[model samples]
Target: MSEQGFKYSILASGSSGNCFYLESPEKKILVDAGLSGKKITSLLAEIDRKPEDLDAIFVTHEHKDHIHGVGVLARKYHLDIYANQETWQAMEGHLGKLDLDQKHIFQMGKTKTFGDLDIESFGVSHDAVAPQFYRFMKDNKSFVILTDTGYVSDRMAGIVENADAYLIESNHDIEILRSGAYPWSLKQRILSDLGHLSNEDGAETMIRTLGNRTKKIYLGHLSKENNIKELAHMTMVNQLAQADLAVGHDFKVYDTSPDQATPLTNI
Candidate 1:
């Protein structure tokens, strides 16, 4: 990886809303605009970026938790909104409130190049209108952002296998989610094959697929009500320890806060 290559940051990552910022000196992009426009703006400001500085916005799905501020942000800043046809159609009603000129539909699997960065969207197992995850590469550096998937399929595993870093969902602890205050239906939904990934699942998946290049992981999309940071980390640690993997030595786990921005990392 070139020292001058692209940089990425997790502005805010959790159940309430998820957003990430990726930038090179010349171009900038946002992945998922789940937060409100004002909040997103404030986050961008904290990172020394303006909404107008973004060249495009890529949405992973149509869920409100992923596209809440997409329309407003794109419309207000006149930035391009790139999504698959299905995702765009699913969000058409909400998107119509924004300027039509900003909408750009490109099928998943088609690489979208933004100057120094190459981006590819791939399918993820999530309950939404065409949900997808993203792989980003610049220079010799690359990473895959995989989250909100209920289970990690073989295909998804293949995509994540070659990455240097992974921003994955460690949504909840299995025991916690099963016995928490949530109703049966909600609990069932979360445990379903199309719901979120549990902390144990995340650890096992990482242990099974992690390569030497995969040195850093940001455990994202945690359920604030059902999962606690220490518990989630400890569960993952126990799971990986059985496989002879140590957290800080093998690969570090960074717990993303629901109410704060996570620090930038080098892959």
Candidate 2:
């Protein structure tokens, strides 16, 4: 409750690319830099910052959309990049070359520090090797970022339930994804246990996971093909509404954009 300074911005989100900008009192960092270095830095400039100002980049998993710009940004800015041991193995070759000193491997479930902030990674079910989600905390307040998982496990829900704010995946609507023009294999992949969250699944997860203290949420990683912003938004809103957890009164939900940066948020 005493957390003073924490900010998060989704520089971009979706299947095409993903990136996040984060700041703590004594450290400036990014969660992922899936965008090109040029695009990432340009987005940074929009917030009146620069790549050289970052202290580190924390990667979630090995997917290209989560790491496309990691190597370039790290090499250009001479910044440290943190990833779990398995993730490092899965993504190292794909990231091109990185200086030895720039690699910082963290143990999953153990806490690591950056100035006033503390970060913890937890396993999440996904197609990639060692895919995961993260919790970032300072003082008693916390923010959580979870994406690219097919379903929300009880354990995963428990881990993130009490966060002050959350950036969670609301990837597609079930009917839309199933009935869309995508091929059968692609549709099955998206609907599988290792695929992505459907809009209804997202709503159910939030109903189970969101605490009374949790106030703000940004629905992210939406699919441009099988989903649209308003559908995802109204889906969750209506679900929560049925649960009597009214939006705006109980909490606020923001739909993240795939093509542009979402508004800066504080936690």
Candidate 3:
């Protein structure tokens, strides 16, 4: 990790929980506190970082798997918590009482600069109150974190069109999801435009997202019941192959696991 780069680790990402550790030389932040405070803190410690070291925590939405640890972590570290007003309101009953002063709201589509980073939030397709994805930029390099969206809009894609690295949701395979044991309504929901992205949907999104500037793109939010890592990986890779984009030579793709932090990614 050089002093000039931006770095990140997917602390945890899946249906169960979602958290990330990101930093530059002078500033550090966490995106979503979806796990237990203890678990997130422990993951930070693994990277030689502490909850107290973070400048802020950005909540993507009000879902339990996205804000479960926000209140606890905010109280523990006295950190700034960023979310839209509606999302903050939706999050309140679930996250317990948070200190009023700790809350900060950023307008969607506006770039907000925090310490050494510039972050822009854009609305994403999801069945939650004001769910969004973020683009983090510094030193002319950018890494985007986008998950839990059923589909990506062209506007949202334009916001993160030039990422150096991206962590995107590859939630399920259509066949597996359709034929699996989930209830019919649940299956329909997953297949809906506002639910979650299938492996094919995620892959098609990647094809549009891949550019000369892109280096690494991580496939995240795989469903344990409806998706396997190998299958999810092959599905996306095969799509790129059809597009004549070589994986290793053009860019890299890796699956993110719910139980472990992905390796440190520097951009």
For model 2, name the residue pairs that clash.
none
The whole-model C-alpha lDDT of candidate 3 against the native structure comes to 0.86
lDDT of 3 by residue, 123-225 (tens): 9988998898799988889888888888888887778786899888899988988889999999988888779988888888888887899888899888889
**Residue pairs with backbone overlap in model 3:** none
Which predicted model would earn the best TM-score?
Answer: 3
| Candidate 3: residue 5 Cα off by (Å) | 2.9
TM-score of each candidate?
0.93, 0.96, 0.97
Off by over 4 Å in 2: 1-3
Q: Residue 85: error of model 1 in Å?
A: 0.7
lDDT of each: 0.82, 0.86, 0.86
TM-score of 2: 0.96
Angstrom error of the Cα, residue 181, model 2: value is 2.0
Write down the lDDT that model 1 would get: 0.82
